[model samples]
Every structure is written in structure tokens, then in C-alpha cells.
Target: MSIPATESDTATRALEVLRRLTARDDATFHEGQLEAISALVDEHRRALVVQRTGWGKSAVYFIATSLLRAQGAGPTLLVSPLIALMRDQVAAAERAGVRAVAINSANAHEWDDVRARLAADDVDVLLVSPERLTNPRFREEQLPELRQRTGLLVVDEAHCISDWGHDFRPDYRRLADLVDSMPEGVPVLATTATANARVVTDVAEQLGGDVLTLRGSLARTSLRLGCLTLPTSRERLGWLLDHLTDLPGSGIIYTLTVSAAEDTARLLAEAGHAVSAYTGRTDPDERVRLEEALKTNELKALVATSALGMGFDKPDLGFVVHLGAPSSPVAYYQQVGRAGRATESADVLLLPGHEDADIWHYFATASMPSPSKAAAVLGALGTEPLSTTALETRVDIRRTPLELLLKVLDVDGSVRRVQGGWVATGQPWEYDEERYERIAAAREAEQEAMLAYERGGTCRMELLQRQLDDPTAEPCGRCDVCAGPWYPTEARADSVAAATGALDRVGVPVEPRAQWPQGADRLGVDVRGKIPPGERPETGRVVARLTDLGWGGPLRELFAPGVPDGPVSDELLTASARSLRDWPWAERPVGVVVMPSVSRPQLVTSLAEGIARLGRLPLLGRLDLADGAPDQTSGGNSAYRLAGVWGRFAVGPELAASVAETTGPLLLVDDLVDSRWTLTVAARELRLAGADAVLPFALAAVG
Candidate 1:
């Protein structure tokens, strides 16, 4: 099998591959699929295809790889973002008799074999994640040769390359360098289903010269769209409980956060529904199992987060129900597009909530790098590479944000990650204020558009299409606004009661910090390595986390900024008491001690006194803030946080005398816990002043 040697011959070969891939004897290319394939196999040109989901984007690449391989071109190199996408693509390629292999975090054990296959020309297509592009061994040794001889380069979910898009990834931004390094006559293809006109233009500019762009209508006639405004999370859960079984078939229930997904899945399962939760925290092996279960109709729904978003293939996912509105219409469109790809019609519904805006604000700000923080990170690095743990001691950013900042710096050429860790590249870097501002403004506009969709004045499907700048936007006549809701909106009274009960049940373990953060001694703190067993606090309990589905609402209200300081509410007090009663501690505390609070003095005092009175324990005096100690806000890396509170709390004469008299562990109470550093510092002070053991209790834990 050599090169076809003619365009007609190439098309004939590609059609055969497509039929094999689809397992259909009469299969043919969709509207623009063959043209894109021809551009790659015949003309060897760059192509961008922005079609709806399930429009055979993968087929274009798989067929092109087959033709190119027959023509004696080098194996196709594919850059994918998610593991699930790679897994599914590998399976699909095998059906066409194209040998495909992948190298990613989840399959590290097979990397050697995969590399051997590539070396022996046993692989027709080689897939690697965008993050792997920067890996030391692969980037330095293999990628250079592969770039020179590559037959075709494909970028799946190409919208991620542009920062203007909703889900911009720093790793994807590095693809421009890879594109520039490709040899002459090597074809390139970029495909995505969620890019709007703005994103399309940005991606095109990055893909470089004379790319063929093929975009089709974004409308999905098989989707029946609708919106139900449910003000509370409990009500939304009740609605699902009442109507989940009534929906067409096995489908997805999307959530805005991991805790919401877990909580929803638990409540539904308790009601005798076969369901499970899927999120970023879920184990990779278990994710594969759950995805299979849904495909086989073994489970009713998998309440999942955006981690399950892109490249998951199920032809007949009967419905998609959002537990809460996503931050933007573009993102919402991408998620709901997962349904109705093969079915005649699939249900799509949005249950909008008031707390959605707050969650949106948190996520939007968390990803963007701060100028001051970036500078701090850069200043901490030098000729020697420092691991993230060591670097955390010198910078004020938290671990997650610190890692994100480093990736952005890497993309900007200000730093480089090597074998040991990261080092400064000494390259000049400037924060793009104007670009970030424009992106922020665009996001605000998208959020407003999403709100308008929820308000329901126009055809639901048309509104989503217009948001994507689809030229074929029009009424689908399948939405609630086009043709009244095809499903019910009411939840039975008993269902609501069940949901309320689930939400009200509370108590989460607050695991004690075992080891001190690395390089803490550099911050003028003497601690390093693990804390001594005697000085460490016991595993404690919180009434709930601020992110919990049930008690989160009240906890958020109580800690919201600008709220007037006040005594503990009776409702929270009762819940706290209940939590304490149910805690399975090895030893009960003989007394209670309070940590001084500047922000909520009245609330902290009241909570401590009430707990002491209820439990018949003495209320020991509170620890005092050292003279001129600055107030600590809940943010920053562990070492920086520890530095702020080092020697900040002092057990005064009265508290010291009371501690000396007590015989058992003392209960340490605080209004809220973020990093748990404050509680650690206060507990250390109490232990040294002569308490036997300390147990931490908090009103709420920050997610």
C-alpha cells in the first residue's frame, strides 16, 4: 500500500476508511467532512473545522491519517487535552484499522512500549496531551524528530488556544510554537464545536497562514430546550427526584461544583435511583467505569462537574439537566451539546439558582494571574530550580494558584520547568493589562447573555445558536418557548421533604495537618518537617463546609463580607450542638478555649460560651493577639500564612493559669477555617502553655 498518487484515488480510500470507522456499509461523509479530509490528504494544507458535536470531526482526521500513511507520509501527531478523549479516539481509530497509541499521565506505565511502537513505525497516529508538549524527555528527544517528519498535526478542542475563550489553558497556548516548527507540506487540522466568531478569529490567527476554515450551523434540532427557575438547591434536587426517572433515558446531571455533584448523587441514590458522582476528584479508573455504566444504561445519571465535559462520546445520551446555570452561554452550549447527537430528541433543562453568581465570581477571578503574585514568584526563582513545595515558602500565593501562575509564566517565557523543578529564564515579561481587561469585559457580556436565556423571551435553541454566532440561527420549534415544556416542573411534597432532610444532615471531618510546610524555617519560623505528635491537634469536626449543599447557604451568609458582627444564630447553634454530639472522638474535652477574632468578635464569643454552657464544660479565657500584630486574611501559601501568625497568639496569665489547671484535652473554637493555619498556631500556643491535647472545632470550612 503506497500513496494513492491521485485526488480521486484519495477520496475513494477515505470513504472506505469512514465506512469502516462507522461500521456502516453505506456510510458517507457529512456536509464538510470530505472537503476537510481532501485538504489534508490531497493539498496538504492547514484546515479549521468548527461544526456541531457528533459531526464527524474525528472521522476527518482518522481518514486523513489512513490516506497519508498509505502515501508513505510520517505518522500523524495529535495533541488532545483530556484523557477520556484520547481513550475514546484510540478505540475509534482501531475500528478503522489505523494503529493508534497515546502517552499521558494515566498510562505512564506503558510509555516505553508506546515509544518503541513509534520508533518501529507500528503506530499510524500518536496522541499526546498538550501538557506533554513541555515534558523534558519528550520535548528534548522525540518531539524534534516527530515535528520534522510528521504527516499531519491535529489540535482537538482548538478553542483552548485562545485566551479569549471561556476555558483557556496555558498548556494549549504553547501549541503555537509546535505549529511553527512543523516542516513544509505537512498538513495541520484544528477542530472545535464551541468556538464563537471571536474565538474562531483568534484561533485562526494562531494557526498561522492560509488555513481553510469550515464552519456550519450550531443549531441542534434534536435537542428540546427549556428553563425552570428554581431559587434554591433543595428545590432543584426535589425536582430531579420527582422527575429523573420520567426523563427519556440514561443521561447526565451537571453540577457547578464537586460537592454539589457528590451531594446530589447521594440524595438520589438514597431514594433508590442508580446513580454516581463524577468530578475532578474522582479516581481515573473509576471515571472510566462510570462512563461505561452510563453508556450501557446501568445507571440512571452521573451527577458530574465540568471535568467530564469535552470529548466524551455517547450517541444517545437522552437528556442533560443542569443543576445550576453555568457562567456563560458558550460554556452552557458546549455542555448540553453532549446530548441528542443520535437520538431524535433529548431533553435539555436549566435550573437557575441565586448562588450561581457568587460561584461564577469565585472561579473567574481564581484563574487569572495577579501581577504582584507573579512578580513575587519570579523573584523567588534563580539559577537553581525549586520544586513547587520549596517555592511556596517564598511566595504568598496558595499552592493551586501558585502552580497556575508558574504555568502562565512558563507560557510567557519568563520561567522554565525542567527535571528538578522551575527556574527563571531571565526573559522580560509584562502583564497584558489591556488583553485581560478585554477578556473580562467579554466574559461579563457572555454572563448577561446567559441570564437573558434563562428569562425565556425568545426561542431557547435560537438564543444559544446566536450566542455561538451561528449564521443559521432560527427557532427549532422544540423548546419550551417554541412549544411548551415537554416535561413537568413540579416536585411532590414528599420529595421536597426528603431533599430538605438530606441537606440538613451535617458534620464533616477536619483532618489535622501532619507535616510543616517545606522551607518554613526560611520565613524566620523554626518549624520544619512533621509536627510532634504531642503538639498536633486531633482530627476535629466542622458543622459543615461553606461548599456543602445543605448547610452551605447559612454558613455563607454568616461569613459574607460587610455583614454586621453579631451573636451566633439559634439555628446554627443547634446544628453545631448536633454535630458535636455525633462526633466520635477518642477523648472528650474538659474545657473550651477561644481564638481571638477581630472580624467577628461577638459571634466567636457567643459560639464558645454557648458550647461550653451546653456541654457543662468550663469556658477558659481566650488567647490574646500579640501587640501590633496585623490582621490575617484567609489567603496565601502555607509558609506565608504561617509567617503572619508566628508568635501572634499568646496565652496570657489568666488563660495560662486556667490551662495549667485543666486535666484533659481542650476544645479550640473558631468562627471559620480557611487554611487551618490560625487554628494550628493557636493550638500550639495552648499546648506549650500546658494543655494535654487540643481539638479544633469550626463553624464552617472553606472549600
Candidate 2:
């Protein structure tokens, strides 16, 4: 079979590239993969690829890059979202004979070397985070040159470009700026596996006019989907204890929070299962090891937050079990799609929690910056770059929300981040109230759909496909809904008890603040350097983190907004007892002093009284709120939190006189520990008074 003369060289080169990439004598494109490669390499046309997970989407870009580089084009620019995904992609690309390098937060030290490689034309592809675009140093120093020479612009997880996407990034929306500045005939490719019709349309529009959109059926026949509506966290944990080993191979156990992932992994490990916790806060090196452990089947599962989502490549993953539902159906489908990629069958189960809706609300509301907050952030920035900590002093917003709002402002051209910190660009900015409201509506709708998926009326797979707007969606006849439940419904009492025992084990190290936040002096706090070891409080105890499995559910309910603040619940008191029993404190307290929780006075006082009664200690008195000072708000960045409470509390003469007679350490109790600044400030007052030590205790700790 000789090639015809009319054929282009790109197609022949694509074939050769595919063979080398796969290391197979006989390797062929999967469905539309070849067409996408040809469009970028041969026709120099932009393309959008929407396919199911494990459909070889990465192959298209890798093959196209190989062909283009050989044709004398410059390196491809790939912007990915997740660090874990980026590491996996770099490894995969290297295995395929492509030289890929990345500049991300995880590998800051190697960026200079990577940049050097890029300049030498020795790198076939260069990857970065979308957040890198808003960086003024990168934007002014590197991006212009790279943009001029980039052969192809690849947005991997392209659905993130649209706010309508389940996992949208404010930074991803900045791709429109990159697209607008691209050189003529420099082809672009956007790829995603979990986009609905709306997201597809939004992404295609960003890729510019005359873009070719290639979408395939979003169906994975190898996946046997099921949903178990477990009534309680205990039941869900019990089911996992009983059935995890029965799953065919290693996979993932998805959790909604980092604490959940950590707790789940700890429980599984205690039960003699080889499991690892993968969360956003996990050290980069540890995350890599965990990912490798899963890939090599050395571990049964990686208990994970959505931090593990987007680009992990595990072809033979046997199952994916969700302890709580994600906020949307498309997001759920994308996660479950990780399994059954190369195998005959894989189990996919969703165990929805009663708190799933509340968790969803927390995340959803967190990402959206109120118009006033956004304006305040912009106003806070100046020509002189301000670090995030400095900006926190100028704006009342908390860390997570402030970071998100800054990114949104950067995308809107109202701010720029330089070497030192972020600066205002002085560009006119609009609130776009209508747009924000529209996205909020979409989120609510998606949330409702997710809840419906849990309720389970139609084929589970069919419902997910429809949520993705798959035209070919139909009854798969392989899901619990269509074929009836294929998983166990009952969990033994012993298993449940074991899980409960793990959850009930409560005590967290209250690491003392080693150094005061820089710039605190401007806020009227004169403290700096390590608090003299003598002034620091003893290690404290909290009932549990609000995200823990055992006590997290009830504590969240108790603290739910609009619920009246009252006395300590018996469970909390018992949990506190566990903390007291386990305390490695040098000596028990002789008296109890209450920190005035203006927002929760009754709860705080009751918790202190309960501890005093349990210890047979005297209830000294409460720290008085400064005259005319408002009760402090709960949420803010560390700097603002400290500023808000710095001068707001005073140890009145009555409390000082009462504490003088007390012996040994004094128990300092509060309803919640958020910033720990409150505890630190209160302890400083107590230590100044005559108390030998101040041991802080709280009902819950919030991260």
C-alpha cells in the first residue's frame, strides 16, 4: 500500500509519531483523534476536542506537537489546572519521546532550567498553570516571546474556561486574552472530558471564530454505575470497611474535604488497608509518591479531595467510590470515569451524605466575591505591589475568598501580579452583576441535578450522560437503576462501630503561633518574633475538626447558621472528656476562665462550665469585651482577624483578682477555634495575669 502523491506529509509523520508514542508496531488513532491532530498540524486550524475520559485526548496534542516540531514549528504551550495532572502528563509525554517541561508552584526551582531548555529549542512542549498568565513577571518577561514562537496553544481541561463548568477557575477565563493575542496561523487545541453543551459553546467561542468542535458520545460501557443512599456517615464508613477489599483492584475514595480524606485514609490504614490521603495540602513530594503507589497497585486506594481530579492517568483503576456527592452531575461523571478505562468492568458507587448540600453551598458561596468585596480588593491595590497578607489588612475578605477575588480581578484586567506581589493595573472594571447572578443560577440548577442523581429514578449512567448533554445518552442497562443493585446494602454493626471508634478519637495539636504576622504593627498590635516561650499557651484540645467523619456531622449541624447558640451538647461534652482523659498536660487546671465569644457567649460559657464541673475546679470569670467594641466576626484572613480582635478584649480587674487565688494552670475554653488568634490573644492576657499556664480548649476547630 503505497501512499498517494496528493497526501500531505503531516499524516505520514503523524503515523510515525503515534507508533513511537505508543511503542507499538500497530497503533491507530481512536475515533476522531487523528482528525484533531491533522487539523492542528496540517491545516493549522484551531480545534476543540470533547471526548470521554481515557479516549486518548492527550495523544492528539502529543502527536501534533511531534509533527509540528519536525516541521520547524516552535514548542507547544500547554496550560493545565492540577499539579498531580501536570506531573502525570509530563511523565506520559516523556515516555512517548516528547521533551515536556512544566513551570508550576511545585517545581519553582526547576523553572529557570526549564526556561533555559525552552530557549534552546530543546523542549518539545512547555506546560504552565493558567494562573501563570496573570503574573506580571511572566507576562512581561517571558509570555510575549513565548507567544510569538508558540506553535500550538493547548488548554488541557478546557471546560474550566467557562464559569458554567463544574470546576471553573477564574484564571482559566484569561485564556481569551491569550487567544486574542495569538499569532496568525498558530493553531490552538482545547481538550476536556467533562463538558456540557453550554460549556462546549462557551469554550468554543473563546477559541475564536471558525474553530472546529469535535465531540463524541460521553458513554463508558465498561463502567457499572450504582448509587447507595446511605442514611448516616456511620453506614457509609461501615460499607467501606466491609466492601473495599472486595473491589476488583486499586482505585480512589473521593471525599468532599481535606479532613475527610485524611480521616478516611487514617481509618482505612488502621483497618490494615494500604491507603493514602491525597489533598491540596499534601506535600508535593508525598502526593507524587501516593500517585505512584496507586498506579503500581501497592495501595488499595487514595482517599482524595477533588484536588486529585482533572488529569490523573490510571488505566486499570478497578473502582471509584464517593463518600459524598460532588456539586454537579458532570463533575461526578468525570470522577467515576477514571475507572474501567482499559478493563472489562469497574464498580462506580456514590454514597451521598446528608451534609453534601451544605458542603456544596460552602464551596459555591466561597468562590463568588460580592461586588463590594471585589471593589474593595481593587481599591486596596496600588502601583506598588502588595502581598496577599498586606492586601488582607486593606480588605476585610478572608484568605480563600480574597485569593479567588484577586484572580477574578486579574482576569478582568484590573490587576497584575509582579515579582514582589500584586498591583492594580488601573483598568476600568465592571461588577457584571447579571453575569454573576446567571452563574449562580446555573450552580443552583446543577446542584439540584446532583441531588436528583442521588435520588435515582432513571439509569444512573443515563442521567449523568444527559447531564453532560450527550445526545446519544440512553439506558445503559448496566447501572443499579436499570439492572438493579449489584452492591451490598447492609453493613455489619461491628464495622460501623470500628469506624465510629476512629472518629471518636479526638485531639489535635494546637501548634502555637511561632511568629506574629508581618505588618501587624500597623494594625495597632506591637507583637513580633516568637511569642516568648513563657507567654505561649500550652497545647490545646478541640473536640474535632469540623470536617472529621465522627463528630463533623453533628458539630456542623450545631453550628449551622440561624441555629440558636446554646449550652454544650452531651456529645461535645463527652468528646471533650476524651480530650481531657488523653491530655498529656503537665498538670490539670485548678480553675476555668471563659473567653468571651461575643457571637456565641452562651455556648462558650456552657463549655467552660462543663469542663470546670468535670474537673471539680472553680469557675473564675469571663474576659470582658472592651467597652463599645462590637463582637468579632468569624471569618477573615489572619492579618484582619488579628486586627479585628487585637484591642477588643480586656482582663478586667474582677477576673484578675479572682484568678490570683487559683493554683496550677487555668483552663481557657471557647466554642470554636478559627484563626487561633483569639486563643493566642486571650492566653497572652492570662499569662500576664498570675496564671502559671493557660490551656485552651474549644468545641470545634475550623480550617
Candidate 3:
């Protein structure tokens, strides 16, 4: 006798229970959330939930899973990146009388149990990391069995898949492939607290599904953001002690290095503030203990690296103080997100200093063995693939250095390897050219966004909203800038007066121009007279003239007597090649000629100094100069000055345009033109706009 459809109708009953839960006062649902849920139910397709931080995103998945389980549809599978989050969710599920289990490295035999339960259809939900999910044996043998009983695939911290995202994880790219191999068209529900429009698109694309975006307000009215420029580390500690000593509840202090974290924790503890340090180096048990202590408010503050915030949730955190600048806004946002989880007043303090930024830049631009190392490793492996350890021995580099090199190469698509081995995939590096270009644009956009936030005379919330693609978002009245109603009026009057006075002193009308002779002259061009001594006569435009006349090679050859005729020492050649190749120049010849003039050690330092100074001048609002010849002319160390200006400009535009294209709408503000970044953004935007290129402009001199 066949069972009747109604007899096995768990799904229908689950839907009813969901409706009832929504009706209860304690389970309030926003209209956007309701609509999002409705869409998911109606489409019967996988949906990605892209919501801002603190928007009750977790509830959507929890309720969805509960409803599905009640209907006997199948268990929900949550692929989380953080183990701590998995434990928390499991505990919460148990408290709610829902059956849940987690499978990770800690419980080595847990996978066997999980697989058995999945086969028997006895489990409600299973939580595991992407790494665990992608295990070859698990995928080949157990996954197929599990997939048949899996209803939903929830990817937490979904932004990690986006190349433009701050925390891009290689493993996440394979998640879409895993989901695709599932038996049923299991709906994927990805959730994240942060991600602008571009990030949203990236998540959808990565998951191979449509997005059900429920972007709640980013405005945290109860939270305050402030930057304190401390001159020394001691001062930063003193400031933290003064503020945190009497504060109630818990707090987190973010440091740049593991050593710094340990040191800071020690300092705080010695000063009688209960503090503990957490870093990647911490054992799993210690980390869990610290997290539990933080949750219980037993620890007043936890000094940590970026590792501490991923999966841990403490609703009562009252403060998030950054001991140093995070590498990017994404990181800064994540750290600050730990605070203000509840509807209470909180504060995020950024102890401003250049040390952290410098350190990050050092790592970002540090020298590494060329792509040849990857090639050599692949060659050594022959037709066979080697494990990471085996490959390290063959390459003769330390595991850490080798891993970093391989990761960079992998990201650059300069090499490919099997998941378990160092053997070349035989396929040429399938570079995601478009994706790489998009990331470059996004970085430029982010740089611009950063500068805009630092310099804009507007409400911080407004700037943030605009950066995040909420163009019409209203000013949040709670920010320092918005709180002072009288300041804007005074600021506007002062700005107008300054503008009027400058215009009078200059005695030149402000107007956009295709080419301004006077502006060109100030830039070292012989606009209205014969070429100056030591200048190219043909172009009569200084650096441009040099490039146009092909005099750069002759000039460089004249300056450096020991310059080699053929291949030099490997190190020297590599240095020379990188200098010639990597310098940010509008024209390649200019970079090639000028790179040798400044020593490699001094280049970045001088550039940083110049950028800092240039950032302050109003008239020089974003200059995009071509990298000039290194040899100085009568116009004052052309390469040094131009490099300084260009470097500053380069950071904003290059980073902004690259990032914006991948991550979406960004507001860039800088003192110099970021030509490289701008060129890329402009190219994409121009294509979208039915154009080829945006005409370059000198914001100050031309206007």
C-alpha cells in the first residue's frame, strides 16, 4: 500500500510552523527580510542573502532550516569558515531542541559519525568548514550520500569568495563547484554582515545563484567612530588604560603582530585590567577558553590579531580599539563589527599612526622569488604532483616563504597545482584576467574612498553609505560631523571665503580646459618659449618631450657609468628588471629611465613622504603625472618630485578604480591623479558609457 501525499507532508507543516514563529512578538521580522524569505519560498531556487552587519541574518537561515527539517525535506548543511561559529550555532540549536552536529578537525572521528547520520537521514543540520567539505575522500565517497539528504547549503561569511573582498579564500572558489554536484538543486543561502554592491554581485556569481539582498541600514546610531592620532605606542596604551579601566562589559583591542598582541595583553594585565591575547599562534584550546572568557565578561579586554573576530560573537562588547591601522577598510569594519552587537551605546577607537600602514605596505611590496621559482618547482615535480611539504624540500625555500610565494603565484595565475600536490596541472595558468583587473580597480576605488573619508567635509555616515553604494542615503545625525549642526554653516562660509581669496590672488578665471599653457608651464613644460637647457626641443614639454624624442636612454646611459651592456648578476638584473617593469608610469620609457636614478631603498620612503605632503594641498587635488626621467632637470629633481606626486596619486586611483569595478560604487578623493587605477576604471566605465577614455584634467591649475 502506497503512503498518501498528506501522510508524508512534513514540508507543508513546517511552513505553517514558520508562519506561526513569525507571528510571535519575540521574533520580529523586518519587511525586507519577510520579502526576501517570501522570494526564496516562491522561487524554490537557491538564494543568497546579502545583508549588512547586525541585520538578523542568522535568524533567516535558522528559521529556514527549522522549517525545512519539520517538513522532512532534509537536513541543512552550513559550510562555515570559523570553527568557533560552528560550535556556537550547534549549542544554540541544541538549546532550541533542534538536533545539530559539527564535523571538523578537532573531532577526528566526527566525520564518520556525521556520514552515518546523514546516510540514515537522522540529522537536522551539519556544520563543517569548506576545507573539511572539500576533502577528496569526503567529497568522493560521503558527499554524494550526504547531498541526497541535504536541503540547503549555507555559506557564512560569504564575501570571502569575491576576489575583490578583503579576505579572499582560495577554497571558497571551489564551493560553487561542490554545490553544483549536489543531487538536488539545493538552494544556497549565503549570509554576510558586510559587502557593498560589487561584493553582492561577486557572491551571487561565486555561488552560481541569484541574490535576495536585504540591506538593512549600516547606520549604528548607538555606536561612535573616532580616530585618535597617538604619537607613540606608550601613549596608545595609556589612552586605552584610561578609557577601559572603569568601563563595564567587554572589549577587544586589535594589534598588527602576534608579538604586539602578547605585549599589549601583558601591559594591560600588569596595569590591573583583566586582559588576554589571542593570535593564530594560540592553541585551539586556549583560543576557545579566551573566547568563552570574553563571552562571560571574565576578561575585560582581549588583545588580538585579526584572527580573533571571525566566528566569535559577543553581544555585549562595548568597545573595539585598533592599536594600529588595519590593512584595509574591510578589516577595520570586521574588527569594529565585534562591538555594538546589541542596541547599546558603543565606541570604535582607531589609534592613528603610520607604523602599521608602513609594515603592511612592506609585506605587500616585499621582494619574492620570481615566477621562475614556481616554474622550477613544477619542473622538478615532472609529471607527478608533490605535497606542500615535498614541494618545499624540492624548492629549497622555507615552508612559510614557499607557501607565500605559491599563494601569490596562484592568485596571479602564474602557476597551477592540484589540491593535494605541487605538480603542475599541465594547464597553463588560467589567469582570471578580468577578475584581476576588477580587483585592481576595486583597490583603487577603495583608496579613493579612504582618502575621501579622511578629507571630505561631510558627515562620516553619508560618506560611508555612498562608498557602500547607498547613494541617496541620508546623513546619520549621530556622527561627530553631523552632531555639530553649527559647524557646517561655519565651514561653508570659511571655504567660500578662502576660494574667493585664492581666485583673486591668482587673477585667473577658473574653467575646465583641454590644454592649459600656463598649467603645462608650471609642470615644467616650455609652453610659450624655446626649450630650456638640458631639455628636449622637439616636444618642448620636458618629460613628455624626453619620451617623444627618445632621449631618456641616452640620458640614463650618460648618468650611470657602470651600467652593464648585457645580463648582469642575477640579483642586480632582477632588481633592475623590477624597477624598470613595476614603476607606476603613464609611459613605460619614463619609468625605465627614471627607476635607476633613485636607489630602491629610498624610492618607497621618498614616495610616502611626498604623498603625505601632497595630500594636504587643496590646489593639487589629484595629480596624474607621467613617471618622469630619473635624472633631474632645472625643474627640481624631476623623478623624485614626480615619483612622489605620482606615487600618492597612484595609490588612490589605482586602488579605487580596480576595487570599484569589482566591489561597486566608490567615492575616490585624493591629492594627485591615480592615472593607472583611473585608466582602468575609466576604461570600464567608459565602455559602459559608450566611450573610449575619459579626458585627463588638472583639477587645480586648469580650473
Using TM-score as the measure, the top candidate is 1
TM-score of each: 0.97, 0.96, 0.63
Candidate 1 vs candidate 3, TM-score winner? 1
**Quality of model 2 by C-alpha lDDT:** 0.87
Weakest ten-residue segment in model 2 by summed lDDT: 1-10
**Between 1 and 3, whose lDDT is larger?**
1
* Poorly placed runs, candidate 3 (over 4 Å): 1-25, 209-211, 246-248, 362-370, 382-385, 401-422, 430-438, 451-456, 484-703
Question: Pairing residues by index, what is the TM-score of model 3?
Answer: 0.63
Q: Rank the candidates by TM-score, best first.
A: 1, 2, 3
Residue range 1-703, candidate 1, lDDT tens digits: 1223254877788888988998998887788888898899889999999999888899999999999999999999999989998999999999999999999999999999998988898999999999999887888899998887799999999999999778889989999888888998899999999999999999999999999999988888899999998768778889999999998899999999898899999999999999999999999999999999999999989999999889578889999999888999999999998999999989999998888888888888788888998989889999898999889888887888888889999999999988888999999679999988888888889889999999999999899889999999999888999999777878888998899999998788898888888788998899988988877888888999888889998999988988999999999989989989999888889999998998889999999999999999999989999965634767788888888888889999999999999999999999888888888888888889989999999899998
Count of backbone collisions in candidate 1: 1
Against the true structure, what is every candidate's RMSD? 2.3, 2.2, 20.4
- Candidate 1 Cα deviation (angstroms), residue 428: 1.2
Better of 1 and 2 by lDDT: 1
Off by more than 4 A, model 1: 1-7
Q: Model 2: per-residue lDDT, tens digit, 1-703?
A: 2232237676677777778888886877677887898889879998999999989898899989988888899999999988778888898788678899998888889988988998889999999999888777789999999999999999999999998988889999989889889999999999999999999999999889799998999999999999998788888998999999998899999999999899889988989999999998988888788888999999999999988877677999999999999999988998998899889999999999988888898888888868888788888888998998888778777778888888888888898778888999889789888988999999999999998888888888889889999999999999999999999998999999998788778887677676787667777778776788777798898888888887877888888889997888877887887888898999988888998875778888888888888878899999888755633577766666777777677888989998787778988998888888888888888888878899998888885
- TM-score: which is higher, 2 or 3? 2
